[model samples]
Every structure is written in structure tokens, then in C-alpha cells.
Target chain A: MAVGIKDLAREAGLSVATVSKALNEYADVSEETRQRVREIARLLNYQPNVTARGLQSRRTNMVGLVIPTMEPHLSDDPYFLDLLAGIADEAAEHEFALLLTRCAPGPKERTCYQKIVRGRRVDGLIVVRTRSQDQRVAYLLEEGFPFVTFGRTDQGLDFPFVDVDGTQGVYDATRYLIGLGHRRIGFIAAPEGLMFGFHRQEGFRKAMEEAGLAMEPGLLARGDLTLQSGDVAMGQLLDRDPPPTAVVACNDLMALGAMRAARKRGLWVGRDLAVVGFDDTHVAAHSRPSLTTVSQPIYDIGILLCRMLLQTLQGKPLEVRQILLRPALVIRESSGGTIS
Target chain B: MAVGIKDLAREAGLSVATVSKALNEYADVSEETRQRVREIARLLNYQPNVTARGLQSRRTNMVGLVIPTMEPHLSDDPYFLDLLAGIADEAAEHEFALLLTRCAPGPKERTCYQKIVRGRRVDGLIVVRTRSQDQRVAYLLEEGFPFVTFGRTDQGLDFPFVDVDGTQGVYDATRYLIGLGHRRIGFIAAPEGLMFGFHRQEGFRKAMEEAGLAMEPGLLARGDLTLQSGDVAMGQLLDRDPPPTAVVACNDLMALGAMRAARKRGLWVGRDLAVVGFDDTHVAAHSRPSLTTVSQPIYDIGILLCRMLLQTLQGKPLEVRQILLRPALVIRESSGGTIS
Candidate 1:
């Protein structure tokens, strides 16, 4: 009972083919004819059934998100929520639905992706938390599938991605501590495999070198991005002959843990030892002392990533594929700032 | 190319119709004959194309979750993350995907659901955070669509659902505080419209009445289930004449906020003013003074809800339709307990 192209064609005094071309923005249709056909279509309230159109176009108008559930508890964090919210925002605007799958990082997960892609379950895919020499990227690149990632891989294959400037964020964080008269600064680094860990470590090293500070072997401790690990790492740092006056954790959870370590040792966080963190998550702002941290625009990154994926699916030019966003430093009470 | 039923029939020395019935678990097929056909099929490595099967059966191995974007920032909370994790776990086990859509509560959102239901976008849906007289529930019930909810509605329709006993949880919270030698107990309640709010408030009142404790008119304050709202409500409670020695916030975030209020008033959380919260989220354990909370196995609820929906879709008996799980009270440091 819905208005069809024939109705628009009859009203516009044109053939069904011409009306279709006009409505679909075909170059064969003249602007005046397109306008007339569009006006008639609007007058008749012609709403296209997207599913039927999708079947004809060989596109499902659905985006696939396969989260690696190797660490099932990781979903308990706000990171995924922020990313999903951004993608969901853009998806609602485009009238596309997100098809989410959670799978382990194994051959079974690979098969799941293959099924989704080969079966035409989704129009495109959005991959997140990319690792070095990622197999998913290699497979998607080889299959020529439409896909985008939140982070880049070291495999050197060019693809669509949006990443935050972690190196600059850490550099700014370290420099901020230096300006606070902290000569011996302790660093809490992330485990070695992640790309952000490498970039952030480099930033810290460069900042220290520029300030003519000698790196103490006991000053830098590696954490597995957990509060417990951060607490242990901070304890090791404090056990040294002359402990550092300030500490920088790669993530906010770790920074919060570091503060707990300081408190356990009966030292004021901002006064005796300044502590700063990365990611500036909600907990950072609400913590008792209010954490000083580097903040990535995670929601914005998610929005941009979805937009980039949609553009790629639409066969947009490759120039808009790569995007890099700056991470800002938010100074709060934990860094000895009273202006929280 | 995979082996078809015809090949299995030929190998098993049975008719194609018999082979088909055996493969599909038809009750008419003999157990011995079915075993013979299954053995031959397994030997040949026959793999069914799920999408093709779905087209024939009209059952897409997909579930729907349309989160109301009226509170978009709500997704940022751990509550959503935990719920999604549970659902994702079950979906993965069943080889099903989740189709997520974030839309506002309005006509447009209703149309979105209708399209998904009528257009066969998903086989079933999972609705959460049930409000009074929810339209989604009404629409789903009216259409006879397969669905399960995380919370129950007041409409009293018999359907599949899995909800924690929030009333008992709050009642237990109030009783626990009273057991800790607190006579004057203050309450930080959730806003009136939410079904849980009503249940929890009733629980608190019932427990208070059972204990012969007089609840003062000035002791009750309402919060919107956020940290800021909890902080505000706690402040109001503290301003009362002879402020209560103990407080109960409806959620963990608000409970944490209540703790902040106590600290602001120069009172020790465990020693001076005991605070309790609901929903033992990740931050509740990691907070400065670990929160005492009512713990609902949210992940388990998700799994059960999905199982109920799947069973309904499969035309299972209604005996396993509704489920209500108990919420346990976890006493931690914030309630003056060292046993976290």
C-alpha cells in the first residue's frame, strides 16, 4: 500500500526508469527532472524499504563489531561504552544498525569474521584495539573487505584508522611534572605489547632527556594496566634508596592505585608525591583528590572512526582514511593543583 | 563443496526423506536409523550454511537490544557494560549476534522497533530498565514477539523475565545497618517513577517497621542515581536535626557520593557514618573505602534472560518463563567492616 516509483513517475510525467535514476542521483538524470521527480515522491510520501533496497544493492546496511572476548571482564570498563556510544550516535543518524559479536582471539574468531563477511551479514566492519602484526587486518586486507580500525597495526598495510597521540600526551604529562619542580620523576609504564605503551614510553624518555635528567634503573616500573599492578609497581619505586617526588601512570586506574600506595606509606599524594594518570576516565574526576591526567577524546574518536568506516563503505577517496587526534592534559588536585 | 543429505542417504542405505527426518531430529525416525545417518554425515564433514538455513526457517540467529538514548550518557556506566557482557557471553555460546540500536523514547523509536520486528531484522529482543507501563513491552506483548526483560513491569502480563529482588536487597541493606548498632538510619532513595525505586523504598520501610525503628520525615532524601545527586541528597540528610548515623543509597555511585558527603562533613565513613549502596560495580570495590552493597549477579541475569528468550523462540514450554534471582549483601569497609 506504500507509494512506489510508478506513482512518482506517473505524477512527474516521466518513465519509471527516469524517476528511479532521479531519485537514486544518477548522472543520466537532469537536475530539473530530478527535482520534479523528488517533489512528486515527497508529495506521495514514498518511503523506500531499506531492507528490500539492500537486497538489490548487495548491502545489508549493517556494521559489524567483533569484540575480542579473550579477557571477558574487560567489557566491564567504560572504554568500550564510550566507543560504542560514539558509533551508535553516527549509526542512528545513518539509519544503520550495529551487529556486535564477542569472540575469543583464536581461529574460531577468525572463522566468525569470515562467515560474517562471506555471508554478507554486514556492509562493513569496525575493528578496535589493534595489536602489532594483527592477523585480522591482514585477512581483511587480503580479502578486500570494507573495514576500519580504532588503532593502527605494525604490518605496514595502509587502511582506515583513527588513533590518539599517546606520545605527545605522555610527553606533556612528564613535562608538566618537571615544571612542578620534580627532578626525580618515577614512571609507571604499560606492558610492552601494546602500541600505546611504546609510544608513551618514548615520550617519557624524550622529555627526561631534554631536561638533562639521568634515568635511574629503579625508577621505571611496568604495569599490566590494572590497579593492583600499579600498586605493586609504586611500592617498588618507593622502596628505592631515594624515591621519586612524582609518578606518572599510563592509565587512570593505575594512577589511582599509585595514590593508594602513597597513602598507605603515610605520604600526601599532591604534597609529598605528585601523581598523574592517563585516559582521564570518570573515576579520575570523582576520586577523593581528583586525578591529574591526560585525556583522550574517546567519544570523539569513536564518532570519527564510525564516520571514516561509513565513508570507506561508500567508496570515498582514500585521502580521508587516517586520522590522528591530540590528547589534552587535565590538571586536577592530585598534581598539587587547587583549581580542581 | 560440502556433502548434502542425498549423499548421506546414499551412504547410509536409507531413503532421502528418512535421512532428512533423521538429520532434523524428527520423532518418527528410528533411533538406530538416525544414528547411522548422523555417523555418515559427520564422516563427510557436512556444514550447514546458517544464513541459507535462516532464510528457509525464518529464524535469524540474532537478538535485538534497543537501549533508550534518552539517557545517552547512561551507557557510560558500568551497569550497561556488565549487562552487555552477560548477553554477549550467551550469544557467543549460541552462535548468535546482537543487533544494537540506541534510540530515544518516542514515536520514532517505536517505528524503529516496529521495523525491526515486522521487517524480520532480529528473531527476538532483550528489553531492560522497565519503567511504568512501558510501550515497548506493550507493543512486544501485543505482537506476540519473543522477548525477555531484565526487569518486570506493573502491567502483570505473564512473560519471560529475570529480575533481582530489589525490594529484599534494600530491605536487607537497611536491616544490615540496624544490625550494626545504628538506630537513626537515613535513606537516599531513587526518583519515584522507576519500578526499582518503589520496590526498594518499600523494602526499606518494611524493614524499618519490622525493627520497630521510627523513620523520621527529615531522614529521607531522593537522588537521581548519579554521584552528584547522591552527594546532594546526602548533604540534605546531614543537615537534618540529629542526622542519622547510617545512610543507604539506592546505587553504588550514589553510595560513593554519600561517602563523599560524610567526608565533607568531617566524619569518617566507617567510624562515624556508615554508608551502603546497591549494584556492587567494579568501582565500588576499588573506592577509597570499599563500598558495602547489594550485589546482583548481573552477568548471570543476562545469561538467564537470553536463555529464556531463546527457549521461547524455540517454542519451549512456559514453565521456565519467569525467573527472579536473589540479591546478596556484600559488607565491605564503607559499612565499618574490614572483611571486604
Candidate 2:
């Protein structure tokens, strides 16, 4: 049987109530006595039942994160891992654990959120992949639960979030392509409903309009943010009567996919065609003809999100409730800049 | 305020005790009353107090996993991400959530184990990176807690585990190197204390011994399983008199690092110095000179470990208490075999 407060009390020569007070660090208990009781408890390996204690304190000291079940893509994507490492490290530093749940997209996702929130499995939650509608955000707001999102929602809800500036990042990439004298640039966008997708699309349109270039509807394609999807989308764009000289993908995975499609068509990346991607993940640096992409500090975003949520859970006033981090474009060979 | 059993009872026009029994699915409660109570509770968003319920049931339905704080490297490595995706997916399928903690190595790691185990924060745990004399394993064994390890311990304690066959993996890589007529080969090994490291080293020695080759002390170097460490270790091996013509790293990260070191010395990877790495991670295939490495189903291992732990937690007898999966050798450009 597991050792308990009674065991500590017996070993410390104290009453059960006194041992409990000492363990709980009640101000009424003398420091010396508390120390002695704690030492005894440590020696006995006495473990206080956290579940029982949570009933009284209403705090589990855990932060919940629900990831979408992206399957094969998730296993290969280093983005989420970087974010998780950051959150796990920060949570550990703050004496908190991270609770992870994987939910499929759609109705099941809402059920997953309700199970965690209503069950009170964690003190707070960190939500990722915010959408235009974002029922998850709506539910959390209605329930008045503490949460921080990795992206913003179209609903314009007032909530704590840390999001990368997708618009500016994509706009800069598009401007770079335009500067390279590419009048017709293909764009592989994230699927509809994702707020980031909308921002990225807006950036592309703004860049084209500012450059006095008419965007051919045939040059725009949507992908499900997968390498395969990107390949198919790029293939469609390449089939245009007058194909684009360059392409911009919403994410590195899609960008790499576009490169693959270019290669399949006997086009050498960085020479025959220029490709740019967003989210400079680990694969972006190691991929053949290394990707030129927009870099976001994904790991740091996770750390800041956790810190914000923990502060909120502690009922502390946040200096900044929402954070919008600007992403920088990283130049590499894939953008055709290395061709001399 | 959060909806309670009383509120659910009031809405359903039933006594609080009857509502509670109905929600708990007691056979004593009629099916019609149970359905009415459940529908009312769902409409009102009545979340049962899991904390209070846990006090009665002694089950949290959570599985704990503690990763080492190997920052910088952790973010770049896809191996852990794949494993995590597997475990997270399986846990969700089984209606369990994963509790994650990041702990530094050494004495503090033990403290982390104590906190999670003693606090009863999870129904079971999944331990990774097992050591030869793992105190965490010993403590879990002593506590009689439900846990399954990703690797084995050398303490001769019979426990449930799912591990890759490191010895066989390295043995095959070594034999393949010998087949390529490389008499002198350097081995970049994992740090001490890790059980996998020991087994991998043993495989290297066995292969060299069987080949009637004399092992040179200067050719052997140890790395802390990071790319930087692998680079440093490879540098030391190259500094030796008549440095080995080929090198085998314990992991893909170190192997890639060793390749970097070779290039810095103005040696062509596939022509001058053959390099091999274990853990055919995603980067292994994408690296400039694709790595010839040992492939383990890391993600599948994660899934199996979770299934085993959940089975144990549910008091189900395992078909196999211990699993040792054989890793395959995937030959690529790095090992000099692709030079035509």
C-alpha cells in the first residue's frame, strides 16, 4: 500500500491533523515542525492524493493541448514537435504538466474539447489551428474558460492568442517574386476555413495588385497543407497555357511539394523556377535545394502561450493579452537567388 | 457557475440522488430516467466533477510520458515527433489522454518521476530512453505502478517493454560496412548509462571481432546523441593517425553531424569516407547524401507501448509481455554504395 499522511504523522510523532497542516504549509504550523514533518514524509515516500486535493483546491496544475489528427502529415511535420517541446519545457518550469489530446477535425473536435473542459481535466487549455468560425473558441468563451490560441479566429473574439503575421510574411515573399520580374506567380494556399489561409490569400492579392499584375485565376490553387496536396495543386498550375515562372506555398511542406512537381516536369528548382514557402521548419533547411521561406519562432510562441495561460490561471494581470509576432523571410537557394 | 448534479436533477424533474445514480449508469436506475437525466445534463453542459469522482473510483484515465530536456536538438529531431504522434493517436483511440512532462537528466529526473507517480496524476506511465540501471524503473517497480518502458533495463527485473533491437541493427550495419571492404571504421556512440547505447556498442564489437579485425582504441568515440556531439566526436576520430575510412553513428543526427565533419576536412562523403547512421528519421532520407541507416518503427513502438500500458491499467493480460522488434538496414547514398 502507498504511504499516506498517517504514516508521516506516525513517523514524525505528530497528530494526523498536524501532519496534514504541515504538508499543506498552513501558516499556523511552525516552520521547524513543518520541516520535520516534510522530511519524514519524504523519507516514507508519502504521496498526497492529488485528486483528493484537487477537489478542495479546484486546480490540477495541468495545461491541455488538443492537436488535430493529421496522421502521416503530423508524423513528418517538425512544426508541432518544436511547439510541444517549448510548451513541455515551460510547463515543467512552472510546476505544470501538459495534457495532450488528438482529435479529428469537425464535430469530433468539439466533443474532445467538451470532454476536457467539462471534465476539468486541466487548469487551462492551449488551442491550435484556429478557423474562421472556430466553435471551439466560441464554446470556451461561453464557458468563460482560460485558453490561449496559436492563431486568430474570424469571429473577432477577445481572447488571449499568439499568432504569426501570415499576411506580412506572404506579402514580402510575393513582393520578392514580383521584384524578380515574375508577372505571373502561382500560389498554393492552405484550405478554406483556416484564418491563416485567408490572411495569406489577402497578402498575395495585395502584392499582385500593388505590382499592377493581374492574378490569373488559373494560377491560384488550394491545398490541404500536405506535400501530396501541394504536388497536385502545383501540377494543375503548371498545366496553365502560360505557366508561372515562380510559386509561393503557404507552408514549407507545400513548397517542397511544388518543387517536386517542378522536378517531375524537368524543371530545376532555383533555376527553371523559383519557389518560396512559409514556416521555415527543420525540413526546410535540409531539403534538397534548401527552401527559401518565412521563418516564425514556433517554439517561442508555444512558450509564451503557456506562460500567458499559466498567468491567467493564477489570476495575474497579463501585460499583453494577445501577441502578434512578425515572421521574417529567409533567403535560400530554392528562391533562385543562388543561381549565378 | 458550472452546472452541477443538483441543477441537472432540477431540470430533469428528479431527485439529486436519482440523477447521480442515473448519470453513473447504475442498473438500479431505470433506462428512461437515465436517458432523461443524461439528455438534460448534456443540454445544460453539466460536467461531472472528475476530481470528486476520481476520489471514489481511483482512476484518472491518463497516461504520463516524461521527455528529456534536450533542447535545440529536440526541436530538429523528427524521431520524437513521430513517436509522440503514435502514442497520442493510440491514447486518444483508447479514450485516454497523455500527460507530458519534460525533466532534465540526473537527480532531478528522479524527482519528476516521484512527483507524477506519488501524486497519482495518471493511471499509468510510458517510460522512454531506458538506462542500464534506471532508478525510475526501479522506483516504478517498487511502487508497483502500472507502466511500460520503450526500452529495456539491465537490472534483470522482468517488466513489460517494447524495444527496438539495437544490437541486431548495429550488427547489420557493421557487417554491411565490412562487406564494403572497410577494415577501419569509427563508431560514434551514445553516452553512457543508456541501455540502447550499451547494446549498440556491443553489436559493433561483435561485428569487428567476427571479421577478424583489430579494433583500434583511437577510432572509437562517444557522443551525447546530438548532431554537434557527433561532429565533435567525428573530428576527434579524424585527428587520429590514419583515421578510419568509414564511420558509423548511433543515430541519424550524429551521423549527419559526422558527415559535416568529414566535409569540413575536404573529404567527399560517398567517395572518400563512407558514413552510416541509425534511426532512419525523416532527415535521413532528405540529407544531401541520403543516410544509409537502421530503420526502426519508432511511431509503431510508441503505439504499442501505449496499448500495452492501457491494457495493463485495464487488468487485461498481454499476449506478449515483452517485444523486441528487429530493425532493418536501409542503404542510401551516404554509405558509398551508390557511387557508380
Candidate 3:
């Protein structure tokens, strides 16, 4: 029903093989032939010449991105969005395409990933959100697939990865809180098991520990990285006897939530609580009495990841395999109060 | 660095072709041979299967998606993200791989698209944000490529498409305002050229025209669908001799901006200036004086689009090539005011 190679050949007055070679940019074909074929192809909107695909293998040159399902927080997190924008920008520049797939945990999620991997689809993978022992990373490792992760692994697998210096970012966030004369500053950390939660928790603890501050065990409260979680965690923290004056939320959503909850309790956010957050998300600015937070170089990270992966694909030696960088602290209205 | 098929064949005491056929689920291979070949391949984590790919052609079994660059209005529009999630879910279910690409306008955008189409990137394409008389669709039409679109097309091409009942949605949105006895309702519409803007305007026009209401030319205004644009439009509308009591923004971000500008002008949003927004994005719910908006089945639209494309690629005819889905109006605090 549609035009075939024979039709194209008859129309162009060239042999089918010559048409195929010229259309495919084969070195054997003359530039004039290639140009003529390309012009016709463009004019006709002719499909790719797949006959020589055996030689070229029809490289899609498209990368596949798989974000874990459980962390809707990553999507809600402005910081993560910035990182994604960076990756998108980099991919756009390199003339390469990217496929983004987000899967949650379930039989459905596992089956979906299995089908893609089993069908020999996708050239490489980019994964975010790593648990201390994440199954997805482990599976990719065992499958001997090429992948770059945004989170670190303690499992000792030598996979290529680029991650922010969350420990240092938290360190900066904590030090700022302390500078406001907040000695009993509490840390609203993520669930202690995940890599980010652990790193941020460590940073807060290390800063407090180095400062020779003594605190009760209940000062460190955990929340899943959500605004709701922050609200709930703040409730629990406030319930304790003699609650801390200042709190550092490991992520921005929690900070926003904490601010809301504090306001509800007639507590002035910056003056009464002196709260700080990480991942200076977009809402961090719009929130009443805007949030003081940590700003990660997300766009730069995406560009760096792209350059690293491209170089590795092109067989160029790289100076660094694992990149760990720091985030800057952005002062806003949320943490403006001087600690009593 | 990796085990070759020849080496595996020698180890398994079979011909290279026989080993490959067994590993690949070929009918000629016995079950016993297949099991043993699979075990060996698993052990090797064998990379580079493109050699055997040379033996056959057709049906790379991949799906393609093209979206515009991540502008704040589009990327942060929860509607698109929700739609993407739905598409990803359905694509995953069919075991189909996705080729995601962001189209920028100009040489880079053209090359990015050209590489995907001419490079034999995917089995089909799914285009988001369809414009009236879109060139991309025209190009695909001229190329005879298989593709699906998530928005309406003015090109009159016979292609599969899934679209929200945008006309109906806007019509209903305006009718709700009319029900509240608001006569001088304003529409803060998108740039006049897009198909989406056209449909939304049609809906609004239809409702007013059907109700025998004469719309003043000054009552209709256009914005680029940014928060800033919304702010500017709101300011301009407020400066009119007799300002509109109610205004509907075609997109949620613009509505938020309108609300902000209203607050800036010291007008109570829900009480003094009733506002409504389309595309019940996440920000709409979180916005101060939460917005009244229409909820398009964004995620469901994605799933339906992907399913239709998958069916088209599988030799199944698209039974319903054009799908105009319904939208639900989420009645919130914004438009619940009493009219004089």
C-alpha cells in the first residue's frame, strides 16, 4: 500500500542498493548521491533505510531514566526537578534523547522493568533514590548493565555515580542554625535507613557532636520526605517536654510543612522556631516568611553526569568516577530569628 | 572482557547458531537446550547481542514520545507529569520501551527530531501539546510515520489522538461563573495561536453565546500562560472602568498569579474577585484561597494514548482514532462567592 525501496529506486533512477547506501550515509556512496537521496528522503519523508541497520544496529542514541516509585517526594522536590532539568538540557545539547520511566514497588513495577531489560531495550539507565541496599541497583549490577546513579551505595559495587554532598550541605544548614544561637536545635531527618537520610543525619550529628552540644535522644525525629510527614513530625516533636527552639528539616517540603504546623500552633516560624530546610525548592521562596534552605548544584550535576557518561561511552579516560559535591546555604525568612 | 557466543557454544557442546536459537526462544530449539543456554547466558551477563540482531528485521518494539522543553508552565504543570505517569504505566504494562525527547525550536530541535525519526529510533511516536495545524504532525504525515497525539490537531490528518474535552471543560467552567450571577466574567486565555487555547476559547465563547450574553472585546484578554503573564493580565483587567467580578485563567499557574496579583491589589480573592483556573494542577490546590478549576483526566489521557499507540503498532487498527475525554470541575473556595 505504501512506497517501497523498488518504488524509490524507480523514481530516483538509481539501483535499490545504491539508494539504500546513499540514504544510510555509507562511505561507499558519493556525496552527490547521498545529498540527492537525503533531499528525496526529506521531500518524501521517507523512512529510515533499515537494510543496513545490521551494520549500524539502529542505535536509538536515547537514554532511559528510571525514577523509583516510592519517592514521589523526588518529583515534588524542586531540587530534584532542577536536577532533571539539567539532564534534559544536557541531553538536548548532545543530540541524544532520554526516556523517563518511573516505577513504584509492586509486581507491576518489577514486570515492567523486566520486560524492558529482557527485550534488550534502552542503551543505559539513570536511577535516583537509593536505599542502603536498593534492589534495583543490585539487580542492574547483577544484570551487568551500564547505569549511573544519583545516590551512593554502601554495597561496594563499582557502578558509575554522581551525588551531591548531602553531608556537607546538612553541615552548612546546621552550622547556620547554630549561628543563630540555636544550641538545642533539633534535626528533622528522613527515615534513618535510606542513603540520603543517613548522610544528612550524620552531618547534623557530626556538626552537633563537633560543637560539644548535648541533646536528648528525642531531638532527632524522622519523617519520610514529604510536607505531610514534616507536619506530623513537628506535631510529635512539639509534644515532647521542652521542645527544641530551632529545627533543620533534611528536605524543603518538610520545612514548608513544619512552618505551616508551627503557624497553626500560634508559633511564629522564624521568630519562634527558627526552621531551616534543604533542597531550596521553588515553594521555599513563595511560602510565607520564605524558607532558608540548602541549594544543590542540580543543573551542574546533570551536565556533569551527561559529560561523564558521554566520555565513558566514547572510550575517553575520565579523571573522576565518583563525584561528591557540596551545596550552598541560602538564607531566607524562615530561620531569621535569634535563638534565646 | 565478556564471554562470546562462540565460547558459550563450545562450552555447551552445540553450534553457535543452535546455542543462540536456544537462548532466544526459537521454536527449533528443544526445551532442554533452551534451559541450558539461558543458564550460561545468565552466568556470563553477556553483553552486545546486536550480532545476532543482524539475522532479522522489523519491529524494534519501541515507543517514542516528544514533549516541548521544560518551561515552568508545562513542566511544573502537574497535568503533564500526571499524564506522563499514566503513559509510563501503560507503556510498561505492554512491555514497550519508550524514547523520550524534548523538542526545542531551531536547528538543534530539528536535528534532535530528525535523529529520532531517521535513525529508526522507535516503532512509533506519541506527541504532547498538539498545535492547530502542527508542522510536526505534518512532517510525520509526509513521512508516513506511525504516531499518536495527546491533543487535538487542526491538520485534518487521520491519526490516532487522545484529548481532554477541553471545549467542554472551559464551557462548563464559564457556565459555573454565570450560575453565580457574574455577568462581566473575563477569560485570561493562553496565546491566541495554540489549538488548546482555541478550544478553551471556543468553550467559553459557546457558553456565553448560547446564553445570549454579549461579550465585550475588552473582556477577553490573552497571556503567554505564565504566572507573570497572569499577574500582568489581572492588573490590566483591574484597571478597566468596570472590572470583571470573575476571571478564569486557562491554565492553573496563571490563575495562581492572578490570585497573587489580586492579593497585591488588596482584593480578597474568593470574596471580591472570583477566580477559576483550568488544569487542576498541584499548585492550584496548594495556592492560597485554593482555586476552582477543571480537572482533565491527565494521567488517564496518557494511558489511553499509549494504549492506542501500542495497539496501532501491534497491527491492531485504531478503532477510535479520535478520543475527546471528559473533564471534571473541582469546585473549591475560589468561585463560591455571593453575587449582588
Candidate 4:
């Protein structure tokens, strides 16, 4: 038979209540008695029933993370995996297990949130890919659930989140290309529904306007953050009457795709046409000729998100609720150019 | 206040015990009463307390998956992510949430397992990367825990598992290289501790013996299943007195790495040195010259593992206790050769 609190209490010559208190670290138990009870519990290899303890003290010691992706193959996007690694690392360090789930990208996702949070499956949740009017965020807020997000939304709510400065990253990349004597620059942008997508496009527009460059409609193409989409978008730009001398893709996978398109058109990447990508994924570093891109501290953001959630869970006051990290432009062979 | 069983019973004009029986679909409850109870529960937005229900039935409706990797950043391995996607898809489909943990790869891992399985955190577990004489399999077997593995171990114990035929994968890759009239072949192997490592090595040796080709010691190099490791291992092979014209890496990442190494030496892949890899990941298809690899139905195996574990969880009879799926060779430009 599995060892229970009753067995530990019997062995330690203490009441079952006393044994439970000692195990849960209740302040009423004396130190000496607590130590004795713990020793006996360890000797018997007793596993404290988390469920029973949760009933008494409303802490499940679990965190929830729901990925809102219709893509069954989330592996294609390295960004999600990196964020997961960061979250997993911090969750482990803080002694919290991560409960993961995926919701189909549509309206019925609120039911998923209610099932886990209202069902008391997890104490807190981690939300990612925040839309402009994220119902998940609103629901969590109204329900007074402890949660954190990887991106900030335009929902006009105060919440804890860790977001990378995508605007500055794209703006800097465009400025770098402008400084390299590239007046005609093309942008392969992310879908407009995403908050980051809007920020990045705005950054590109601001940079082009500041540099006194003409922002032609043909120079801008839309991509859904996939390699194939990048390829098609880049092709659209190249087919213009005056193709862009330099190109900037929203993410590394798309950036690599742009390079392939340039290569197929017999243009040398560094000399004839320059390319830049965001997110600086591992593949970007290993790509032939290498990709110059903006690097987001993805793993660090994950750790920070988890830490912030833990502080809220522990009822500790946070010094800062909103944490924004800067992304840096990594120079490599793909954007090679001498002084203008 | 959250709706409870008592509230449901009162609203349905039934006793608490009768409501519970109807909700659980007990034989004592009539079909009309069961439907009425369910409709009333839904109307009230009543979420069954999974924890309290689990206390009575000892079923959490959650499965566990722990990745045993020393590398804190598991994003580098696309294979792991694919497996996760597969597991997540099936878990969501079955109305079961997944509990994920990362055991710091060492002796401390056993404590992590005990905490989750023994503490009743999950109903079953899914094990991957089976090692020779795996203590995990042994422990789960001894405890009679409902678990399934992605790979088999050398423990000589009968258990439910969903495994890809790695031996056949490598054997066919080697045979395909041999068919190209390339006798000087190099092999990049995974770490020796993994059961798949042994099986893949045996396949290489058997294929070479059948082809009457010399298995030179200098032509064999070991890698830890990373792109950089593949590059270093491939470099070692190329440093041989007469470098092999054809190379086979245990995985696609390493194969790409080996191709990088060959390219650095000014050798054109598919022309000078043919390369083949296993586990045809997304990158393999997008690589510059494209990679030839053995494709394991990773997503399918993930779904299969969850199905098997669910069967064990529900106490249902399994049609086939042990499932071994075939791995097919996907030919691409990387292994382009006729009479090399």
C-alpha cells in the first residue's frame, strides 16, 4: 500500500492533523516536532497529496501555457520553441510544473481558458501572441487570474508582460541599409493582425521617411511569417519596375527565403542586393553566407515572464509590472557593405 | 461563487447522490435523467472540479512528458519539437492536458519522476530517447505505472511502445550510397548511450559487410546530434588520408553540418561529396542543395504513443501492444550520384 499521512502520523506518534500541518509548513507546529514529522515522512517515502493540500490552501503549484496556433506543426517556428525553453527553465527553478495546451486559432478558445482556469487546473497562466483585442487577456483580467504575456496588446489593460522592442529592431535595420547607400529598400512584412507586425511595419515606414526615400507601394509585400511566403513576397518586389537594392524580412526563416529568391535571380547576396531578417534564429547563423538580422533575447524573455508570474503567485509585490527588453541588430555577411 | 454539484442537484430537482450518478453515467441513472443533468450542468456553466473528481477516481486526465536533455535550449533540436507537436495535438484531441517537465540530465532526474508520478500529478507518462538498460523504463515497469515510450530499450521487458525503425533507416541510406558506386563512405554516429545509436551503427556495419566494402576506422566519427557537432565530426572524417566521397549522418541537422564542412573545403555537395541524413526535418527540405534523408513519421508516432497510453489509462484492450513503423528514404540533391 502507498504511504499516506496517516502512516507517517502513526510512525511519528503524532495526530494526523499535526502531521499534515508539519508537511504543509503550517506555522503552529513547533520546529522540533516539524523536523521529527518530516524525518518520519521521508523514511516512509511519503508523497504529500497535492490535490488534498490544494483543497485546504488554494494553490495548485502549476502554471498554464496555451499556444494559439492552428499549425499542428509548431516546430516550424523556432521563436515558439525558444520561448518555451525559457519558460520551462524558470518554471523548473521555481518548483512549478508547466501545464501546456494548444487552442485552435478561432473564437472558441475562450472555452479552453475557462476550462483550465475555472476548473482550477493551474494556479496561473502564460499567454503568448497577444492580439489587439485578446479575449484571453480580458477573461483572465475579469476573473482575477494571475497571468503574464510575452507580448503587450492594445487592449488598454494593465498587466505584467515581457516584450522585445521590435519597432527599434526594424527601424535600426532599415537605417543601417539606408546608411549603406540603399535608397530603394523592400520590406517583407508579417500579417497585420499581429501587434508586432504593426510595430515592425511602422518602424520600416518611419526609417524610409527619415532617409528621404520614396515609399513605393510595390516595395512592400505581405508574408505570413513562413519561408514560402517570404519567397513569394520577395519575388513580387523583384518583379517591380525598379526592384529594391536591399530587402528586410520580418523573421529569419522568411529572410532566408528572400536570399533564395535573390540567388535564383543571379544576384550575389552581399554585393548586388543586401538582405536583413529579424529574430536571428540559430539557422540564420548557419545559413550559407550567414544572415544579418535583429536578435531578440527570446530565452531571457521567457525566464522573466515566468519569474513575474511566480512573484504574483507568491503574493509578493512586483517592483515593475511591465518589462520591455531591447533587441540588437547583428551584423553578418548578408548585409555586407562598406561606408556609403 | 463557482457552481458546484450541490447547486446542480438543487436546480435539477434531484438529490446530490442522484446528480452525481447521472453525471458519471452510472447504470443506476436513467438515460433521460443523465441527459437532463448534463443539460442543467451546461446551462449553469458548471465545470466539473477535475481535482475533486480525480480524488474519487484517481484519474487526472493529464499525461506527462519530460525531455531529458542537458542542453537547456532544446529549440536547436527540431526533432523534439516535432514530437511535442504530435503529442500536443493528440492530447488536445483526447481532452487531456499535457504536463511537461525537463529533468536536468543526471542522477537527480529520478527524484523529478517520483515527484510527478508518485505524487499523482499525471495519469501516465510518455518517455523518449530510450537508453540501453534504461532505469526509467525499469522504474515505470516495477511501479506498474501506465507509460509508453517512443523508443525501445535493451531491458528485455515487454511494454507498449511506438518506435520508428532506425536500423532500417540507416541501413537503407547506406545501401543507397553504395548503389551510387561509392565504396569510400563516412558515418557520423550519435552518442553510444542511446539505444537508437547502437541500432543505427549495426545497420551501417551490416550494410557495408553485405556490400563487401571496407569499414575504415578513420571514416567513422561520433556526434552529439547537433549541427556544430556534425560539422566537427565531418571535419574529422575529411581529415582522413583519403576522404570518403559519401557521408551519412545519424540526423538531418548533422548532415547539414557535414555539408557545411564539405562546402568550407570548397567541395560541392551532390557533386563532389554525397551526403545523407536520417529524420528528414523541415530544414532538410529547405537546405540550399536540399538534403537526402530517411523520413520517420514523427507526428504519427506521437499520436500513436498517446493513443496507446490512453488505452492503458482506460483499461481497454490494445489491438497491438508493440508497434514498429517503417522509415522511408527521401532522396534530394544532397545525395545526387550515379557512379561517383
Fnat per candidate, as a fraction, reads 0.32, 0.65, 0.17, 0.55
Ranking by DockQ: 2, 4, 1, 3
lDDT per residue for candidate 3 within B1-340, as digits (tens), equals: 4466887798889999998788767899889888988888777655434323522554555677766743622344545566666777788777565666666544565555565566566778888787787777887777777889988888777777888888899899899989889888888889755788889889999998988888877887788787888988888887776988999888887887788888899988889879999998666665556789998767677888889989888888987899888888898888865573
On TM-score, the stronger of 2 and 4 is 2
Ranking by TM-score: 2, 4, 3, 1
Could you report the DockQ of all the candidates, in the order they appear?
0.25, 0.63, 0.24, 0.58
**Deviation (Å) of A39 in candidate 2:** 3.1
A1-340 per-residue lDDT for model 2 (tens digits): 7777778888888999999999887998999999999888878777788888888899888999998755643654678888998888788889899999888678777778887788788999999988999999999998888999999999978999999989999999999988887877999999889988888888899999999999888999999888888899999999997888889998988888888888889988899889999999877876668899999998888899999999999999899998999999998989883222
Scored against the native two-chain complex, candidate 1 gets a DockQ of 0.25
Clashing pairs in 2: none
Query: Which regions in candidate 1 have their CA more than 4 angstroms from the true location?
Result: A1-53, A261-268, A337-340, B1-53, B262-268, B337-340
- The per-residue C-alpha lDDT of model 3 at residue A289 equals 72
Clashing pairs in 1: none
Q: Model 4: residues >4 Å from true position, as ranges? A: A10-14, A22-40, A264-268, A336-340, B1-44, B337-340
Model 4 residue-pair collision total: 0
TM-score of each: 0.82, 0.94, 0.85, 0.93
| Candidate 4, CAPRI quality class derived from DockQ | medium
